[model samples]
Target: MLTTSQILKKVKELEIKSKRLTRHLFTGEYHSAFKGRGMSFKEVREYTAGDDIRFIDWNVSARFNHPFSKLFEEERELTMMLLADISASSLFGTVLARKKDMVTEIGAVLGFSAISNNDKVGSVLFSEDIEKYIPPKKGRDHGLYIVRELLTREGKKKGTDISRALRYLNNTTRQKCIVFVLSDFLDPGFADALRVAGKKHDVIGIKVYDPMDMQLPDAGVLEIEDAESGQVARIDTSDYLVRKAHQDAFFRHSEWCKQVFTRAGCDLLHISTKEDYVKVLQKFFIGRT
Candidate 1:
């Protein structure tokens, strides 16, 4: 556990770095990627030569004896909700940093980016249950608070119940908003809840993982414990069958996740600990454009 001072120092460092990254390719792309509620009328102006005929205000044009057109702008203010999984499994990582650490950094970046675009940000940090819920609000302080919670809040329970988290989100959020679900996705049976949320909001799932999650390293015989369940097992990493089985299980779970998101018409991003998640997110934003 981090001390209060250490946590605050780390949070400050994260905010600096994340804001720098966001100012680069992130914030602008983020703004373009996720659209607003709808276009709103700004004002009526004199119609130009190339103005669309549909936008010409006949009543105003007739009153003024001139061609007038209604101009509008996109309603860009939005709320971005982050559903972060803080389960014990997220603390397991064999390369680079733990899954939790990566999730925190990415979450910070997203939060800062949203606030930069004049959007509100909120979070639901969950383990076996929801640990904390930060209501959506706009401001630098709110973004900082969300990042601090992401770094300092520890899971009281060990397991991951993504379904419960999604249900909570549905119950609390009444209107449409942008929802970003960040997790290692160690738990199953969340397809139904995810589907319902997808119907009302722009849902995106980010599967954060370590290299070991997919393939076990060749370190001979080893004792491994399930981070969530506390079940221990001995396995021979030297055996080809053992390694293949480990990879096969990961593949099956990944497939299920992909299918669920696809069926729900949601977007999914796969990020390994070894990869640069910031770049991946920027690329995704450009792709959306």
Candidate 2:
């Protein structure tokens, strides 16, 4: 548990870091990567030789006996929501940083990016249930406040229930928006909700993981506790078969996550605790461009 002062200090540090990255790294890439909803009809004008025939205004063309093309302008305002998993599993990490820290930093960067693009940003923090909801709003102050909440807010429950979070998001927001769900994705039975959410909104899944979560070192006998269930078990890591079994289980989970996201028609991005997330995010944005 972090003390209030510690939380405040960390929030300030993250705010500074996120602001700098948002300005120097993601500003333009983020804008071009995600466009607003479908273009709205402006006004029809006389069709030029190069005009797309698909956009020709047939009604106007018949009235004037000449082709007229419809004009459209992109919708400028966009809404972005972050669905964060605050389960206890996020507290486990044996690398450069904890999973919780990585998620918080990523959330900050995303919130900053949304605000920079003049998009309204909001979030839902969940752990087996919806824990907190921040309504969509614009401006830097709201982004900062979201960063603070990400740093200080702790989940009451330790288990993960991503389906509940997705359902909640679907019921509450009617507007088409970009939704990012950040987690280690340790939950089950979320595929249906995810598919439904993806049908209406642009959904992306960001999986945050720790290397140790995938494999255990040969450190003789060790006691491992499940972060969500608090179940403890002793295992002999010195046994090669035991280590292999753990690795296999990790790979199975990873494969399942990939399949789930793929079936839901959403993109998946993975970040390890030891890697620099900025590079991963930059690659994703550039790929979209």
Per lDDT, the best of the predicted structures is 1
TM-score (C-alpha, index-matched) for candidate 1: 0.97
Model 2, residue 281: what's the lDDT? 94
Query: lDDT tens digits, residues 96-155, model 1?
Result: 999999999999999999999989999999999999999999999999999999998889
Candidate 2 TM-score over all chains jointly: 0.89
lDDT against the true structure, each candidate: 0.93, 0.92
Error of 2 at 53 (Å): 12
Q: What TM-score against the true fold does each predicted structure earn?
A: 0.97, 0.89
Best by TM-score: 1
Alpha-carbon error at 83 in model 2, in Å? Answer: 0.6
Instruction: Put down candidate 2 lDDT per residue, 1-289, tens digits, no spaces.
Output: 7888887888888888988998999988888889877799999999999989999999999999999999999887899999999889988889888898889999999998999888999999999978999999999889988988888787999999999999999988999989999999999789999999999998999999999878889999999899999999999999999999999998898899999999999989999999999999999988997
In model 1, the runs with Cα more than 4 Å from the true position are none
Error of 2 at 94 (Å): 1.6
